[model samples]
Target: MAGFLSSWPWENLGKYKYLLCGPVVAKVLYSRMEEGTFKEDWCFHISILFAVRVFHHLFWSSFSNMLFLMPDRRINHQGYDFKQIDKEWDWDNFLILQALIASMACCLFPTFLESIPLWSTKGLVTVMILHVAISEPLYYWVHRCLHRNKYLFTHHHSVKHCSPVLHPFTAANVTFLESLLVTAIIGIPILGSCVMGYGARSAIYGYVLVFDFLRCLGHCNVEIVPHQPFQTLPFLRYLISTPTYHELHHKEMDTNFCLFMPLYDAAWKTLNSKSWELHKKIRSSAGKEERVPVPDFVFLAHMVDISAAMHAPFVWRTYASFPYTMRVLALLGWPITFVITMMMWAWANTFLISCYNLRTKLFETWAVPRLGFQYFLPFAKEGINHHIEDAILRADQLGVKVISLAALNKNEALNGGGTLFVDKHRDLKVRVVHGNTLTAAVILHEIPTDVKEVFLTGATSKLGRAIALYLCRRRVRVLMLTLSTERFQKIQKEAPQDCQNYLVQVTKYQAARNCKTWIVGKWITPREQSWAPPGAHFHQFVVPPILPFRRDCTYGDLAAMRLPDDAQGLGSCEYTMDRGVVHACHAGGVVHLLEGWTHHEVGAIDVDRIDLVWNAAMKHGLKPVSSSVTEQQES
Candidate 1:
């Protein structure tokens, strides 16, 4: 899907070649059991075969159609503005028609393979060439005629032209007549070639794969084809059909009608000028070079290198630790208590350093820094709160619409599970968010549908309790770990009797037996790896994971957010704490800002609004990990 061959001409080949051609190459070596490479069953029915084909198309098309909703996996880097896909969900009738048309092709092609042999390399190549040779001119003329004819244009062809922008799914969005016409154009040529004894079964499949691949590519709106060859070697300009080339045909409505190859368009003098220029602009060795505008929900971040902060210089260490020692001495009535009190007063009365701008883009963020030791120090609470408030006020002054309090900032500001600070400061222009709703949502979404046996640590916490209830409702067996049996009983008693059967109460991690999926809440900070199950997939809610993942175990943080089309932008960029995107709590504030931008009531978002943030996150390239672990490598 990244790139193909290494040579100058072939290196430009994209996923189309791999997706369309690789299968043909594989099939040639090991022909299927039905192709007489193995025992043939006389009981095999053609209707069953046709039904299989229909179901195959239905399943794959449904899955591929949903891929548009995920930005990271998208073929095109440009994000879709309108949620046309949500509208496309009602296209069940169109899918049926598509399946019928594909099934009909299956019947004509390999099902009638008495005379035709399995396609060799030459046979497959010949079929593809003939298909392009025969179909292109006829398709061009017919398609142009449909556009020129007012009645047909308005009723049939215009259905496709209605979408000025094209997408992979958009290739299937055509009227019934248009779909039939396209199938006929493609089918007639390949079937004719097979009858002439120049084609094989492999060729038909290759043609089908190529047909879908090209249509999908033509509509992808992303111009992946390099312009260097066309620019340097002028004669090669007419050899290929680029995304920009087809897009021009959509925009202008009277040119570049050739499919796959641009030779016919050049001959007919219908090649678009704008497409040539666009190709030149994006013709670098790396393809696209432009930096997209930073998304509105940009993550505001700061470094929290625990190891570095803990080992600060002597003066800074003394500055941080002195207050705690003096407080202890004052409590104990140690000598020089008066002097210690005065020093403590001086420390408390010191002016705040204040948070300031660290990064800028669609949203700006002011970073607040503190040594890791400061969080545990006696003077830390007041200082941390002051910094958080300062950051919020600074963000508001700087015109930041929303500010997400990341990590301990959330802890200090919210006081470990209350919204009093944000609630009290209602008059501020900047909206503050903890971004936990979607974090919980992301974790819940990652739990597999087939998951039955589950282990949840810190089940007494808000997030753990919510997840336990959710899993119980799904009737999945849940092992809930808490500090005591009393809290476990409290949760168990809260559930309906019907759900009680699926709930297991425990006070220790070792009691969680045979559960493959482990949801470790913020409260359960297991220092040793053996505390978790062998080969377990750990979902850590904290930024720096509480448990060090075992060699066999997979781990991820709660910071999973996506960007547009997995575009080479902010989300994928390497950062200090984690290499990829920041935590969801950081991005959560961005999501809240985006919610407000869309005119939704936005403030401190709750778990109920997860869908809104989740949907918006995907649109902007927030990739959803199947499990709640944000820090796992995408395999």
Candidate 2:
């Protein structure tokens, strides 16, 4: 989605030339994937992985969804917000896992002569069975102790419960030391028994190998491993464990200890079907709490590299540990930054050469083309996205006229429902150049005549500064306005050009984010709600109180339209032929309107604190679209 190509004339015929760079991009990305888990060629791999996982589930076990609350894998009763220990009641099975790993390693390594080898198939099978026997009973007892003895807290069995809510990958995080101890205890005796040709048989060795892989597959954090590994054969049911069965064991630690079967837990009457219900409830709550704020991973990646670089340059040692993950990332990240930054520098240079004051207009317009929202582009830059997404939401909610102030290389003016195009004014005196089809969007919208002239080309905060200056000089009523860098720049620039003498007086007055709003606030921020200019009572036109809400505020209100009892049925008798501008207002703002023409929405302004108009001068520099500026500049 970030791979957006702007729809513009000059943007073509460049290094970013979309056609020729595919092979080069592919090679660079593929090479990075070979080095580590962070694969640059992830688009295809992730899709393949997802497909494999889904297929595994269809042919696998019988769980409806992976997030099914079960005792074994997840220990659903535990707190979902915090990590809980795994309850390995089936110690024998876990021991079997350790034994299998160690036995295979020992067999592979000849240097470990002191280690007895389950080198033969028969020997391997004998050792494996023995391991299953010894660990199984011990675990059953320990498992009982965990619940029966209050002294043994859950943490002791922590590793067992890791993926309380299991997917396929949850099987690997077992504690190393705990696994080692189990391996040593089970392995030595098995090897000793395998004296001479007493090592494990080939069949048994194969079983061990398959068993290890299945154990991991069964306890995965995802349900991609299929519902049942041994499908269509009841006899081979024990071959690959299902998440449902194993997950129950972890969660219901007091039960399911005997290996290769749930028969033990059932015969012993330790497993309860009702516990499944509790498991569901717990994980459900956890899923709710899973709403994590999206982190700025891009920024985080940069910091990691910068820190590693700083430390390495300071302390040099003879033996260098592997480069920090951050350092490696920095090396990769710098190239991307350089490529992007250099591209920006080039664009700025080229644009300046092509057009001077019009550069900003072209650049902005080139990003979001006029009326392009009619056919949604899924790929767009983050900045343009924020505006478009919000715009889309507003458009679909309440059809609107989206007037964009950009210089497209086409006809000077264009118009569409929910779309409008504004070019730099060739004749500044008119302030607005109405085309054959273009409706007055920005320059002609609900803004006052004098303010519209004042706000000509500025962006958001610049418009606000312009308004402040004009109001101060003309001694006009001022209302609320937004504060920020744009406001600062506009005041700095427009004040000298327009409001010089009253500059000192204007400097005494400042705009801030603290504005009061209970109206059309969906598109704005908290600061806009809070720091509104002092006394010009800032009330939000949260006019969109209902779902079909179009523009954060409705331009009209039904409550205000109720006619008085004396003025009933004017349509017939006398047809109280009245019509200039019918404005029905309440204490807050506009409620309804009946006139030859109606304006935007019902928003009350004290007219005391408001300035003349916004000076959007800083929009050229991407300063925020000030709240007032956003309100004022429609087209």
Candidate 3:
């Protein structure tokens, strides 16, 4: 029976499992449509209860992520992986069942049908007393029993225990049987208050909210509550459970079995002795010496579009878990993201987006709260640079070894490929890297060694110029597509005298009609792509990759590389790249830190260092993605 009740009926429904709530939704709609029904109908109450609980859960989820951004406050240094995220994805299913039970109770009980007052002092007192006398003791004993009984532990309690590192969602990551027992434990206090004729709407709402809030707080994995409170009133440690206390339970089971209160654990002598000491240590580390460990490397990035903003970890965890792709449903979030974008423009600063560990080093990604289009706005340039500069300064102050500027943050027209800050703050100890040296390396290495000629677009840009010069030196004929003769000649002169003849100037796409190799640095229309001959492959560094017009021609993704096997705790994908893969620029920064290079890699790419950077990246176990020439056969 326990095994049968362990899993939810809709567990196999996948994303469509929300359809299970159709009946309650229809009930609410029916009640609203009936003109004779009161505004506060039972169905309306159920709907409101469900919505409020969901909102409460989301609040904790988001708030905990905010705390997670501050690494010093984290209790467990070890991070969670995608499997744990998948396991906890359906944590809210139990809430749906609870709502259905509420609807059933409202239908069956005549006493529950009576109009309840907003607030009742007697009801509040009764709930507190019942919770202390009934819920806590019952849960404590049942919880202990679940651990002691092999069958219960294996079939029921083990679900929650699977996640050693807890997140806010872990609070509800339990089997259906355990969820039912939890519901009953929570229901006793409220139902008891009603039986005593002291129940009120406020008491019900307040108790449920407090219960959920504490559960989430305990599992949040960050030690938020200070040790000062317990220091002043030592008994408070037994009255309220902290994140560190609960963490100890997950770490060393068979102890700290009390729910919300350690008082019961104390009475049973089940509380771990190190709980208080560990909590104090975490608090003291964050408070007294202020020893927040600095990240070894930082990849500073910005949003590409509204859809990209939705992929932020805090915004939508499930959406971010998979590789990002433009979807029709993503358009629905435009209004919400637009408002957030505007608000960020006015008030926000640089913030941590995600992080991971590679061997002994810690790497973090930080975001400037601006979208891609904003980088081109003339008025926004100063503000964007200011944010970028601030982030660089913060990284330097924190003793970061390498900080890489990504995407538009390294635009030549804006901050001169991060040169502005490096030149202005010459005394800065942190090495500022544009990381375009490896960007050019990744793009250059994608061209087949046998291909004698390649047509290039955005021919005069930073990456474009570097590729042109490098290819010319290889004696590979380059069709540089640009009308600016002076700019074309400038790049041509940078090559060795003998190879200068290989850099051919072209003004139109018609020149590349016969060339089977097309390097696209600029966005091209379908008309431009039509000029490419059949079987031509387009190697690109363009942001928001161009549309594939010809069926015969293949297009490559932006330059990226897969991290080494030693990389750990990478739970989310990087933009549209697959899991464990990162943009070439991000990989460049990691290689810079690992190589212990002290020079700031900003401004123009040194054609000399292109092979050096590529070789160094390979030496460090960073594998090029399939889009690179080395992996072309597999791709």
Candidate 4:
């Protein structure tokens, strides 16, 4: 019976589970339409209550994620996984159930149906008194019983305990039975005030707001309340629960069972002795002082487009846990993303997006407040560079060892492949790296060693030039496709005299029809791809990867590397890369920081260091995703 009651009746409805509240919503709307004006009625009040609760939960969830992005501010260093996120996805079902019960109560009781005043000081005081005299103790004992009773704990209360490291949504992540008990605790106080003839609409609103505020505060996983108040007046610690205090309860299940106050825990000898000390320590660590630790590495990245914005860790954790793909349902969020994009474009600056730990080293990802399309605008170049420059300077001031430029931030046209900053700020201590060395190495390693001839596009670009030079050094025949004879010969001349003949130049796609190995550094159309013969494989480094046109050919993903097994706290994917994998350039930055090399890796890549970087990466446990062109081959 307990197990049966634990599951919601509408649980199997999936996305349509919201229809459980449809009847109440329809009644409220119909009332408004028939009367043509708002009224102080049961349906109207219930609708408002539901909306307010929804807003409260959303506000805390978003606020908590904002704090989570800043590694120093997080109290619980353990990261949340997709399993926990999916488990808590239905946390708000309790709110809907509570509202439905309130509607049913209004129909059964005449006192609840009576018109009530919006505000009353006496009513507010009565609600607080009743809550202290009744709700707090009742909840304390009920919670204690749930924990002490074997059957109840296993069947009803254990679900909420699954997420030991709390997120804001964890507050209401309870079974139906436990939610009902919580509703009773909340309703008893308000109903007691009404029975005593001191109830007001304001009392109900105030009590619920305070209840949710403390619940969310306790589970936010960030120590927000300072230690000064407890120092100034020690008695205040008994009256309120801190995030650290609640976290201790989660960590040590047998202690700190109080709902919103430590007074009960104190009386029952359930308080953890280290709560106050741990709170002080966490607060001191996150303090804005000179002693705060700076990240060793920063991967400076930006959003690709409006659709990609939704994949941000803070925006939607579940969506970001996997490799990104275009979903039709994601179209619903475009309006909200558009408004945010406009705001970011107008006034935003560089900000931290996410972070993780690789052994003892701390790595972070920071975003420039710009999009993929914005990077190409004629007038936006200077502004984009300003943001990037500010981020680089800021990282330097904070003692950051290395900052890698991702995607368009390394555009040759924008900041000359990050060479502008390195040349302008010659005195800076932090190494500014384009990280294209490892990118070139990863691409070059993907080609089969036995291949004698290869066709290359975008042969004159930075990565393209490096790949061409490295491949030519091995005495392989290279068919470089470019219209510019000057730029083609410029790169050809850099190769050794023996290998210069191997770097052959071609002007049209038709020239590559006989070659089976195609390295695409530039986007090619279906028409251009049709020039390749059967069984040809396309290895690419282009953004927004080219379409797989031919059924006979296979296409490879962008250059990426899987992080070392020791990498920790990485719960979100990097753009379209698989879990625990990052773009090759991002891994290059990590390698640079771990190796403690003093030289800046900005501007043009050096052909000599291609094999050197690749060997170093393998030594550090970073594995290339594409080991060979044959591995990516598909039917």
Better of 1 and 2 by TM-score: 1
lDDT for each residue of candidate 1 in 1-635, tens digit (9 for 90 to 100)? 21121112222353233333233334433545437553222112222333454344443443332321232222334322223433232223343444445444444554455556665676776676676677887887788788788777777666566553465556666666776677688777566776776766567656666676677666766555666778688777666677777777877888888777777777888777777786655444232213222233323334344332221111121112211122332334333434533463455421211111113335433345653445667766777677666666655564556666655656533355325555557676666666776777678777667788888876766667667766787899888876677767776776778997788877666776466688877545445346666777777665455645477777755546543342221211222322234456666665566456523222333444666667776655566644433434243
Per-model CA lDDT versus the true structure: 0.55, 0.31, 0.87, 0.86
Estimate the TM-score of every prediction. 0.44, 0.33, 0.93, 0.87
Among all candidates shown, the one with the greatest lDDT: 3
Counting clashing residue pairs in each candidate, in order, gives: 15, 85, 0, 0
Stretches of candidate 3 exceeding 4 Å from the true structure: 1-4, 35-40, 67-71, 77-80, 110-112, 115-119, 284-289, 326-336, 627-635
lDDT of 3 by residue, 199-240 (tens): 988898899889988998999888889999999999999999
Using lDDT as the measure, name the better of candidate 1 and candidate 4: 4
Deviating ranges (above 4 Å) for candidate 2: 1-147, 153-155, 158-164, 167-181, 184-215, 225-231, 235-239, 258-263, 271-325, 329-635
Model 4 lDDT per residue over 1-635, tens place: 55757888778888797787888788788878888755656777788878988878777776666632445656766566556777898988888888889888877884554756778788899998888889999999999999999998999888888984698789899988889999999998888888887889889988988899999999988788998899899999899889999899888889989998899989999888988888888777774644245789999999898999888877767678888988886798889988988897777787777777897787888999888988999899999998999999999998999999998999999998999999999988889998999999899878887899999998999999999999989988889999999999999999998889999899999999999999999999999999999999999999989999999999988999999998876768999999989999999999999889999998899989988998899899998887473364331
Q: By the lDDT metric, which is better: model 2 or model 3?
A: 3
- Summing lDDT over every window of 10 consecutive residues in candidate 4, give the lowest-scoring window: 626-635
Displacement of the residue 3 alpha carbon in candidate 4, Å: 6.3
Best-to-worst TM-score order: 3, 4, 1, 2
lDDT of 2: 0.31
- Candidate 2 local lDDT, 1-635, one digit each (tens): 11112122223354343333244335446656776543333223323333443334322222322222222333322121112112221222333344335434544653543333324555665665655565444545555654565433333334456544553324433444434543454455345545544653343334444444455555543323332323445444333334455666676665655444443455577754643344344334343423211110000001112233222211211001222234453565466555544464344311100000111111001122212332233353333333433433332232222212221111112222113211222211111111111111111223333531121111222223333454445643333223344554545455435444343321211232232222222234434333333332222212222243223332212111122222211111000111111111210111111111122211112232222111111221211112343455553
The model with the greatest TM-score is 3
- Is 3 or 4 the stronger prediction by TM-score? 3
